[model samples]
Target: MVATGKKLSLDLRVIELHTQTKLAGYIKLLQNNMRKLFFGSKINGVMALYC
Candidate 1:
């Protein structure tokens, strides 16, 4: 039972790590889209079609 408790703790740590990484990736993607919108594309296009 002690070993199983340890395993559960480790699993929770891994899940938290994955969630953080996923959030970071999402933020980076949003930044990229904002750059595209300001540089060459219009907000209309970016917001409507994601191009």
Candidate 2:
């Protein structure tokens, strides 16, 4: 049981890491789009909230 629990926790960690990386990539993409749309202006409140 302990081994299974450990394995499950490890799997969860891996999944969390994957999700974080995916989110980071999406944020970067959105930032790029915002920059293009705003002519390199800072990300505003609405865009920040979306990210």
Candidate 3:
């Protein structure tokens, strides 16, 4: 019974680590999207002025 409890604890730790990694990946994706959006708008504005 004690061994089973220890195994469960190890599994929980692994899951928590995975969750943290996934969260970081999501944050990076969001940052990239925001950067692209800002850059896209700037380019659009310049094009409008030239056109």
lDDT of 1: 0.89
**Candidate 3 residues 1-51, lDDT tens each?**
999999999999999999999999999999999999999999999999999
Q: Tell me the spans in candidate 3 whose CA falls farther than 4 Å from its real position.
A: none
What is the lDDT ranking, best to worst? 3, 1, 2
**Candidate 1 wrongly placed segments (more than 4 Å):** 41-51
Top candidate when judged by lDDT against the true structure: 3
TM-score list, all predictions = 0.73, 0.73, 0.86
lDDT of 1 by residue, 6-50 (tens): 999999999999999999999999999889867665657666786
State residue 16's C-alpha deviation in candidate 2, in Å. Answer: 0.4
For candidate 1, the per-residue lDDT at 26 reads: 100
In terms of lDDT, model 2 sits at: 0.89
Candidate 2, residues 1-51, lDDT tens digits: the string is: 999999999999999999999999999999998778786454565677888
